[model samples]
Target: MFSNLSMGALGLTADLPTAIDLAAKHGFGGVDPDLGYLSGLGGTSAVSEFASSVSEKGLRWGMAGLPINVTAPGTEFAQQLAELPAKLEVLNAAGVTAVGTWVRPMHDELPYRRNWALHASRLSLIAELLADSGIRLGLEYIGPKTFWSTERFPFIHSLGEALELIVEVGAPNIGLILDSYHWYTAGESADDLEGLSDADIVSADINDARDDRERDEQQDLDRRLPGATGVIDLDGFMSALRAAGYDGPVKVEPFMKSLAEQPVDDVLADVSARLAKAIG
Candidate 1:
């Protein structure tokens, strides 16, 4: 596992050039690709030029957020799906091989079975689209009970459930975006991750839960930087990744309120140090 700089996840703001500079300066091995920044450059040629610059700095590309929103209405989803090919072209030119999107753990109207099929169908289409560009798609499972409780029906909120959906999608490129926050909240152990190989995971996020709350009581956004207070079992998490031979980027996704209030440079330096400590 290698440390990755995910600017938005850390609540830091910078242009692509500046983000790359910060990533290199902070000792990150990878930086999450800013899809908006790449798209703004207008074409594959411009994106390739920018990608070369990042490559020269010795930073590998971390997973990019999937541009299509799976939870959107059917028409909107179709439109986004239609536009996916062009967006993927830019990512391919930039050498980004992985992208991810989260699944809402509940739905207002759809029951569990219906919701599962809906997600499987949508994600299958996306996985196929990504595979055409030689990219892998990571599907994130939202594990906090607080999130799923808000709706009428609970969907996939655990690693096993997410794997089931991935199988339903039935595409080779479909995989997991294994997150420590979710892994902890879902009552999973390091043993639960032992079954997965490197190919089973496309990317990962490392964060800590607040000590004040029990596992199920945790909220998705109420997280600390990795190693903060040692509230979460990060060592076991990293050990499992190693056991699985996972060589992908591991980015911090701490949605701490205090972290969001700090200066970008301070947040970057602090997050970088925290990640190094946690992973080591």
Candidate 2:
């Protein structure tokens, strides 16, 4: 496992201090910052200050999630290309190691194989752009309304398909970002987790899945906390990670009202405890 497992930005209200505090308290080695939250802290100028805070707290530098649409057509494409260099500079200033993003062609617009290729080629460009900065690019398998290269069709999803594409790009700076919820939503079994390579494992998220049926919002399987009564075979999943040789950083990623409402410390304490039991 990554000696530096970190919390996503939901913990700190984007406050570097709270993030620093919680991470230190919980033995977390780093944090995966949501850039939107970071902007709310003090905008781009705060990067240096934030980096200093992290260093003081003794946290390894992690990624600042970047917002870019690599597959957008026309001038929008130019916009992403133009803005990325500046964004990368900001991330580098913050001592970030990876740049994670979401990109998938609209399902109706591109054939799966072709979309996969184009996306891969574009990632190669991003890899080249960040080559000297030591920042890498990662693509997450998105939920509905986005295009994806998945093993289960019509049910479409998975970073599994992107693995080969990253190899084709052949840049050390490109890889995949993944979450258990997405893998479950795509109907991927624990067996699917066996194929990851460390170079391809830049980002990781944790969540649980239950029935999709609309409930009093209490049973909304799509956004439950880990250990919440659900059916995400985490033991099997972790086994697959070990099988895949992915001893990388992991993040506790509960994304619902209950978990999100709790104080950061309380939430993380719960996550850290559950993760201990889950991983064991």
Candidate 3:
């Protein structure tokens, strides 16, 4: 397992090279490159340079965000899909092996079942696209009941439900980007993950919650750093992942605004230390 720091919570808004340097300096094995930065640098040639820089710092490219929306309308979605092949080529060149995204409900007017089917169909096609590029697609499910209540139609909000959707999608390259905050809010325990295999989990996000707040009341922006709060059992969560054979990077994704208040280097150091202790 390794640590990743591309999430907005870390407040590290430096350029890609600076971010990778900070990640290595702070003892993280890898860093997720900002896709926008990558694009600004130019295409395949720039990606090659970025990969070389990462290797020089003894770090690996962990993950990158997808630029296109696969669930958009027919023509828009097709255009997005068309753009994916080139993106995959860039990722492959950069040595990034995973693409991460959340499964959000897009149409408020649609029924839940209809939305689910639509998601499955689109994700299945996406899985195929990633498969061709030899990259895995890490799909995240938003697990907060509050989030569901705010949505027009309910969607997959638990690991079990996400896993079922992955099965329905029927793509070997499709898997969950499990988040501890989501897991806790979903009211799921470590034991609930016992049946999952390593392949079922493409990546993971590790963050704690405020003990004083109720699970449903805790918002995404209110998360605490891993092991900094006692609400989520970090040790148990790691143990469960180990038991399930997950060996991917476990990223810190706390959305605390306080992190942004601190110096970026200080925040990175603190988060890295906390994650090391939690994963140990």
Candidate 4:
């Protein structure tokens, strides 16, 4: 497995070029570039230029934002689907292997089963679109119980449930973008990871949580850097991924506001050291 850094997680508002440069300088082997930034650049030439810059810094491109929205219905959704081919072409040229999006309960007004079916149908279509490009779609399960309570339809919040949804989608390119924070909140054990095949996972995020809060009580913004706290068993998490044959990038996605307030270099160095120790 390799270490990757996400600019959003770091709370660094740097543009793509600066983010890539920081990622390489701070010991990250890969980076999850901002999709918004990439979109703003526009066209295949811009993507190629970004790819060249990443290569020049010796950094690999990890996952990027999803190129299309699969769940939205109607003309807006149709437009997103229509634009997918060109967007994917740019990503393919840039050597991006996967793209990811979060799956949460957005339609609380609908019954859970109905909403799930709708999401499944849409995702299957997306998976089909991405499969032709040899790109995988990574779906992140939102695990917090509070997140579910606020949703119109309580969505799948567990890794097991997410896997079930992926199976129902029945696409070869669809997989989980496993996050340690969600794993902990969902009450999943290391054994859960061991039960999965490498193909079931497209990528992963590594971060710890505050020990002061209860598991279900932990908020998204309450994250700590990996190894900064003992609320999550990160070493065992990595071991389980290895056991399951996952050799992909594991990104540090600590959402701590405090870390974001610190110097970028200091935060990056600290994160690198912590990740190395945990991965070791």
What C-alpha lDDT do the candidate models reach, one value each? 0.89, 0.64, 0.81, 0.82
Can you rank all candidates by TM-score, best first?
1, 3, 4, 2
Tens digits of per-residue lDDT for model 4, 1-280: 7788787876767777888888888888888866666667777788788788888888888888886665676688878987888878877778888999988644657787887888888888788889999999999987777677776667788888888999899998999999999999999889888778888888899888988989989887678888777889888888898888887778888777777678989988887787677666
- Quote the positional error of residue 125 for candidate 1 in Å: 1.2
Instruction: Give the alpha carbon lDDT tens digit for every residue of 194-265 in model 2.
Output: 666677677777667555542222221246666675666677777777777776566666556565576767
Show how many residue pairs clash in every candidate, following the order shown. 0, 0, 0, 2
- The top-ranked prediction according to lDDT is 1
The candidate 3 region of ten consecutive residues with least summed lDDT is 4-13
Query: Each model's TM-score?
Result: 0.97, 0.77, 0.94, 0.94
Cα lDDT, model 2, residue 205:
71
lDDT of 1 at 187: 88
Off by over 4 Å in 1: none
Count backbone overlaps in model 1: 0
In terms of lDDT, model 4 sits at 0.82
Runs in model 2 deviating more than 4 A are 2-12, 34-49, 143-156, 211-221
